[model samples]
Target chain A: MKTILSVENLIKKYKNFKAVDDLSFDVKKGEILGLLGPNGSGKSTTINCILSLLKFESGKITIFGCEMRPDAYDIKKDIGVVFQEVAVFEELNVIDNIDYFCGLYIKDKEYRKKCIDDAIKLVGLEDFKKFYPKQLSGGLLRRLNIACGIAHKPKLVFLDEPTVAVDPQSRNNILDGIKKLRDNGATIIYTTHYMEEVEILCDRVIIIDKGKIIASGTGDELKELSKIEEKVTVEIDSLDEKILEEIKQFKNVDEATYNNGILFITYKKGKNNLSSLIDYLKKVDVHYDKIYSERPTLNDVFLYLTGKELRD
Target chain B: MFLHNLKYSLKTLFKNKMLIFWTYAFPLILGTFFYLAFSNIENSEKLDIIDIAIVDNEEFNNSIALKESFRNLSGENEQEQLFNIKYVDLAEAKTLLENDEIAGYLLVEDSPKVIVKTSGINETILKYVTEEIIQNEDVLTNIIEEKLNSTVIDGSIEEFIQNVREDAISMLDTSSLQIRDITSKKLSYTMIEFYTLIAMTALYGGIIGMTAINQNLANMSNNGKRIAVSPTNRIKIIFSSLLSSFIVQIIGLFILFMYTVFALKVDYGNNFPMIILLSLTGSLAGLSLGLAVGTIFKINENLKTGIIIAFTMLGSFLSGMMGITMKYIIDTNAPIVNKLNPVNMITDGFYSLYYYTTYNRFYFNIISLLIFSLIMIILSVLALRRQKYDSI
Candidate 1:
């Protein structure tokens, strides 16, 4: 796929601290690229620098095969940014807010009107076309914020933590609306700290820490970087240390530990780890109500690579 | 894009209840309070004819000029009467003074002497009239002595005396007492409150302009961030927003002007066109000052508003909004302070319209306000021209 946006050796700084340090990445055409990081991890700064909203000390930002600058109007018109914070006018109703923002990029009144209607429908704000922002709930307001940002139907969109602080249902709705945008042949750059959101939406993921990309690939490919293959958990009232040692001696068993009336046995590789644990517990007359095995997740991969959880 | 931004900026400003309260409702409320506080001044200034007594003594009869001055002051023309005089004997004059039925009693001896019960405006007026009559009496006596000494004595002496008396009274009458000047007039002293209120209204545009500029600055508001990243030129957006603010400011000022004119009956004099021009220019100065504060402060909206209010009230205080003496003191000691202050410029403009026949002072104020506005605009544009921020 053709690359739609690229940043090379980007460096943004405050008075003395670097906010985005030597960052380099490329977003493919017509794909949802997840930019994930923890709090204070340069996610917002990187996006701001890419949009030319911040003064970067040194960098080359190319959009549509041209160098991006502060005065790059041609590049800016095709881009839409839904900031992490809601940015809709409290004075304007749903439809007017969308129309005002969309008009900046699409001047034709007829086309702008259609775009406004399409944005309202896309964000499921059809019932709130005339309601002011202050009258809307937090989730509905978030949807309106998204509509204002993407009403002009730009070719490239940046959604920065768009579903933050929203209900589960609203989150699902937002995720669905974003997928629809992707299906309409528009590229999206999504930023969030939620690992599950990234795993669900991103065609490719870039995980950063300390202003640097630490990992990038498909979710499964990244998960493969984790050292542990699978883990078997058993819910039991009590367990002896000698029994933990015995579980550790099983085939390909890495370690076993018991805490809070539960037993956990980690494995690097073993197809029958759960079955073997079940058989041993049955023979030993150890009472266990539930036993299950799970594969390593993206968070586990992040922890293995960065010595911390994705949220930490 | 500029028009789109402008249209929404108008809607945004109108819908902002807080901005409306500060810029429109609050100033009107202040003006109403000012009117109520000053409503009694005109009534207190309208004076009734001061009742005075003249002692009917032989010396009073001999003093022809003093007697004639009393008759003229107590004349039958009720509208312009300065006094209502009673000719009575000494005993009757003493009774009137004791009964407090008169401001004072005048007795003519060597020169006219005034005796009063208490010191007040009416008593002061009686004393002032007696003193002026005595002065004219002395001048008449001096003229007759000079004529007798410098001319040949003949039967024409009586005729010459009559000529001197007529000439002296005529000159005194021409330059007579200004007692009637104390009545209610257009440029009353208390009207300074209204003039400064108008000036305050003009400077309240600063608050409107400040709020409007807040919507276009990235660090100030989240909407500003959205605007910053938009394809529209930043300068165009600033212009549209400021223009919208100016319109809103003028609407607020017009409401105050109308309320003062019809409801409170403030006489702004016969310079309506000049007043309007000064108001427009003053409001632009206010708006530009607010824009400058908004762009330069880099603080939150509330703090910036506080700063504008602090300076605006300071300007108004120096311009006689609180007390006219303050403006007098500043004009005497530190004229440059008010010379550069937009509030003072606006107020002086109104004062010129009320008091001066020439438009020199009014024109000077209008030009000063325009220059102040230009400086503020240049400063604000300097701060606003940057397309990118170091931190947001």
Candidate 2:
């Protein structure tokens, strides 16, 4: 895939604080690039610098093989940005807000209206065409914000935390709308703190911490960074400390903890770790309610690499 | 693109309840209070003929010179009467003064004395005239003696008294004093307050200008950031937004003119076209100030609002909104301040229409307002030239 956007040695500072420190990355064509980070990370700042909304100390940003400057309207025309904070006008209804933003890019009235309708449908706001932003709920307002940004149907779109503080249904709706944008031959740069969203929606993920890219790859590739292959949880009424030690002694059991009717264990790159633990529990006469095993999640991988939870 | 931005910008601005209130409702309410406060003020300016009395004492009755001087000055010769004197005793004279039927009374003492109950323009004029007569007593007496000797014997020598009165008037001219003194063709100082009120209404359009510019600046709002990142021209966005703000301002200006003219019955003179020109120019000055304020700093909406109000009220204050004398004082002390202040420019423009016979002063104010607006807009455009900012 061709590179649609590229940033080299991007450094943005605020007073003495380095908001983006020597950041370099590329967004490939038609790919959903997830910029995953915790709160206060440089995700939003990076996007702002790329959009030329903030002045960076030193950087080279290129879009569509052309250098991006503040007055580079030719490059800006094919780009869309949805800020982390909602940017829709409180006075305008849903349709007007969408039309206003869409008109900035598409001048033809009929085509613009169609694009606005498509954006509204994509965000699942068909029934809320006339509702003002203040009248909408937090989730609906978030959807409206997204609709305003992408209504122009630019070739490249930047969605910064579009699903923050939304319900599961709305989050799913937003993620699906993003996917539709990608399917409609648009490249997406999605930034969020939600790891599950990155895992579910990102084709290529770049995890940032403290204004630096700590890891960048596919979800599976990044998960492989963790040595622990599997995680198991067993539900039991109670377990003795010595019996938990015996379960730890089982092959490939790296860590084990038993608390209040549930037993948790992690395995380091070994097969049949769950069954082996179940066999040890049976031999110890430890009656369990249930047992399950699953792969290490992105948070677990992040914890392994950074010594902190992904959310922290 | 300009029309599209302008259309939606109008919708957005007009829909905002707070903006409409500041730009229209608040000014109209304040204007109503202004009209009520100053509605009767012009009526109080007309000076009426003063009614006075002469004390009928032995000194006044026995002296032919004093009697003839008083009689001739009191319209005995059919000249424009300065006073209508009643020959009353001392008690009756005091009674008339106490009852407010007379402005004051004159006593024929060794060195003639004038007395009044309270101080006013009429009272001051009477006292000044009495002093003038005392200073020129010898000239008047000689003139009266000359008239008396030359005229033939007649019971009523009115022409002789008329000649004496004419000689006295040459020594002390007091022909044009009235209750409501309008010496300069309907040019009343009370109208300055209304002119400044109109000026204030025009400049309050600054709030509208600020609101319009706030919608498109990157540091001011998220809508601004969105517009900043779009492919459209930033200058065009700002121009159209200001254009919309101007339309709203004109609507507000029109309504205020109607309310002041038709409702409050303010006589704004016959220079209707010049009035419109000054109003539109003043509104532009206000709008440009808003544009400058919105772009020159990264301040929040509330702070920007405070700035516009502070500057506006300060300008209004110096332009004589509180009192017409303040504008006179400022013009006397610091002519450049009113020259720079847009509010003063507007009020001064209206004043030229009321006070001056020519349009020269009015044209100067209009040009000053336009230049002020142009400077603000140029500064705003310079500030807005940078597509990116150090901080949002």
Candidate 3:
């Protein structure tokens, strides 16, 4: 696949603190690239550098085979950015706001009108064409913000935590609209802290922490990197600490814990770990209601790679 | 692209009711208050009549012409009267003068003289009256001698004397001597308050300029961040936004000007076109000042607004917006400050148009305003040239 965006050795500093430190990544054409990180992990700073909206101490960035600079209008014309903070004019109504932003790129009156209408429909803001920003609810306002950014139908789009404070329904609609944009041949760089969103939408995921990329791969590939092979959860009526300790001694069992009449077990490269646990439970005469085993998920991989430290 | 930006900018700025109130309504309201407070002062000055005393001795009784002239001067024609005369003995006249019951006392004889404790407007009038009486008596005596010597046989001496007395009374009529010189084109001192009000209105354009800068700079607002990332050139954005703000401010100024001129009857000179042009330039200066301050200061919006208000008010205060004497005080103490202050330049421009027959001062003020505006705009553009921000 052709590379749409490439960053090499990006370094952004604020006095004594480094916001984006030697970051390097690339996004291919016609694919959704997920940048997953906690707050202040430099996801926004890195995106800003790529768009040339921020100056870096030392770095190189290329978009569509051309060096990215502040005045690179040709490259910028095909790029769209939806900021984490909604940035629509409060004085303008929904339709006018979208049309004004769309006019920034598409100057043709008729064509710009069509693009604006399409964006409005895509964001499900058709009923709010004449509503000012202050008159709209938070969810509607978020949708309007997204429509304003993408109304020009640019070939490349950047969505920076677009669903940060949106309701579930609006979040779902925004995600679906983003997918439609991708399917319509627009390359997307999606940044978020939610792993589920990355799993659902991203083609490739890059997990970052402390201004550095900790891991980058497909979902299954990232899961494979984790030491946990499976997680077995068993619900029981009663369990003893001695049996839990014995379960921990199993050859494939990595860790076991019992709480509130439920037994949780993690395995390391084990086959049929659930059956083995059930046999042990029967032998121990521990009555259980139910048991299930699941493969290691992307969340586990993210935790394993970035650690379980609390981040703000 | 410029037209598009301009169109949207106009729409956005007009919708801000608070901006509209400050730029247009506040000035009109304040102007009305100034009108109410000052309209009566000029009228009161016009109606005042000076009081004087005359000694009623044998000489005063002998001068029937002076007594008749005094009666005619103190007639029922209120607009014609220059003095209210009181007849008394020499001792009583001196007592009245000493007690401040009258401005001065007249000692009547062949040559009348005025005696007063102090000199003032009333005392000056008394002196002028006394001199005029003496001069008229000399002229009448000369005319009588010339008629008797020439043997002009038209009428009797009594009839001739009566004709001369009537002519002398008509010539000495104090009614024609205007107390306040209303015919001269000196502007009312109260008009200074109105001029300063207009100056303040023009400077309110700064708020709109500040808003434009806030909407364009990346660190100022979320809207600024979005626009900063767009493909549009930053200069285009700044130019279009500033132009739109100027247009809005000019419209507000025109409304205030019309209200003051027609509704409140405030004189802003007869050169309508030049007045409008000066207002436009003044608005430009105010707007540029705001843009420069907004770009240079990395503070919050409310704090920036406060700074703009404080700065504009200081300029107005120095220019004598609060009182007419303040401008005179500043001009006497520190004339250079008036030349440097933008608000003073604006008010002075209007003042020159009204009071001066030549455009020298007016053009000087306009040029100073233009130069100040250009410097501010250049500084703002330089400050806003950075496309990338250290933080947003």
Candidate 4:
């Protein structure tokens, strides 16, 4: 498929700080591209640059092979942006707000009415058509936000944490709606800090840090780049000093820790590592609780790449 | 796209009913208050009579005609004509003046003079009317002297009368000698017309406030942002706003006119068309000023408040609340600046009623008002052109 959006060597700088430095990516048609990053990792800045809402210092951005500016109406017509913060006319009702935004692109009143109805139905907001923004619940507002952005059926949709504070049901509904858009041959740039969401929805993921893409691949492909393979846990009553030493000396064992009568072991790279750990545990004759073994999740991959710490 | 934006704009305006009520309803309410206040002033009494005491120094020795004229001043059919005379003696007249029953006493002597207990009343008219009556005797003496010229002999009595005639003529010609010059009565005008003019101004100004806030809020919404990003330029946006404001203001002005003419019984003179023309110009000027202010300010909460206060002050000041004399001062001292002020044009439009019976300045003020509106709208467009919404 052809690329719907392409940015080359995008560099955005403040007075003395670099917000987006040497960042580059392409969004192909009919694909859900996940832009996963921690807070303040220049994810919002990058989205803003693509939308032409902010000017970058040195970069080339082409939306449908045209330069974006104040008069770039044609290019903007095929793009839909739903910001993290809900921006809607508080004075207008749900149907009116959707109609207003849709009216921007579609001038014919007859067609606009049909589009408005379709949008309301798509977002499951038919019951609250006459309700004002302030009267709606957080979930309903999020859905309304989506409906407003996508009412015109743009070819490319940018969702910036669209489900940041929504309930589980609303989150599922939003995810399903986004998938439907991609299924209908529209490119989507989905940004979120939630790793599980990225793994579930994105056809391809690009993990970013410090305004640079650290890794880019599918879920399994990203897992292969991680330094640790498997993690095994053992519920033990008491760990002897000698057993701890022997476990540390085992081959492929990178680190071991014990807390709350559970001894966790991390293997550098091994498939039979969990069985070896269980055999060692059995030979030790240590009383324990339940034990389990699991492969590395996306969160572990993120921690290993960006370090295990919270950032602003 | 332009109509689409306007449709959503009006929808947004109506959806915020509380804002609508405050913007439109408050002005109408305040206009009603002004109408009532001005109507009260219009219905007030004018041209009241002044109280005075009459002192007859010659008792009943006066001529019958003189006695009748004096008695006529006492306010009775049998003895009433000029003044509400008390017909008191000198002592009683003094006592009456002291008791405050009369403002002063008229002394009918060889030369008329007024004696007052104090200088409490407007003595200008009193002195003027008193001297005017005495001057008429000189004119009669001139006629009598001319009759003496037809005398058969040139005796001392004829010479004496002739000498009196010459003396009267000379006395009338002297600059220092005071004459009794009768003051002409003024026609009483109903206060309703003045109240109507005032009501028109207040309503016009109030509508301006409403439209200014409307445009300000229109530019504040997301739809407003979306419109800016559309192919329709800033000029079209301003044009649409001005058109909307103009239509609404005209409706309000029409309602105010009906209320004043039919309900309040205000006769806007025979030049009804001219009055309407002035009203239209005034309202447009006000509307333009409102829109300009809205366009110039940042689209935020405080714009409405600021525009309302500024439009009100400017409109009232130019609408002649600064008084007619001040208007003349401004017009004469700074014609260019005064011409540029829309409120001044509106105020002058009302004043045109009194000067030119046929509405001479009607076209002049309308054109000036239109020009003022155009300038304001141009400024607003320029201001909006510089606006670029980079982010929140």
The DockQ leader among the candidates is: 2
- Expressed as tens digits, the lDDT of each residue in A62-100 for candidate 1 is 998888877788988999999999998888999889988
Candidate 1 per-residue lDDT over residues B258-315, each given as its tens digit: 9989988888887789888988998889899999999988999999888988898888
Q: Which stretches of candidate 1 lie over 4 Å from their true place?
A: B46-184
Q: Could you give the fnat of all candidates in order?
A: 0.69, 0.88, 0.60, 0.32
Better of 2 and 3 by lDDT: 2
The prediction achieving the highest TM-score against the true structure is: 1
CAPRI-style quality class for the chain A–B interface of candidate 4: incorrect
* Global lDDT of model 2: 0.83
The sequence of per-residue lDDT tens digits that candidate 4 reaches over residues A1-312 is 788888889998776688888988888888899998888888888887776556678888887878666567788778887877676888788988888778777878898899888778777888999999999999999999889888888888888889988998888888888888888777899999898888889999988887888888888889888788888888887888789889988888888887778788888886788778778777877666788887877777888887864233
DockQ of each: 0.53, 0.62, 0.46, 0.21
Model 2: TM-score for chain B? 0.67
Highest lDDT scorer: 1
Clashing pairs in 3: none
Query: Which portions of model 4 show Cα errors greater than 4 Å?
Result: A13-18, A38-41, A108-110, A207-215, A223-226, A229-267, A270-311, B36-38, B45-221, B224-242, B245-249, B252-296, B303-345, B351-372, B386-391
Winner on TM-score between 1 and 3 is 1
Q: Candidate 2 residues A1-312, lDDT tens each?
A: 899999999999999999899999999999999998888889999998998889999989999999888789999889988888899888899999999999988889999999999999999999999999989999999999999999888999999999889998999899899989999999999998888999898998998888999988999999888889999999999888888877788778789897778799999975988777778777878888888999988888778878888788
- Model 2 chain B: weakest 10-residue lDDT segment is B175-184
For candidate 1, the per-residue lDDT at B25 reads 89
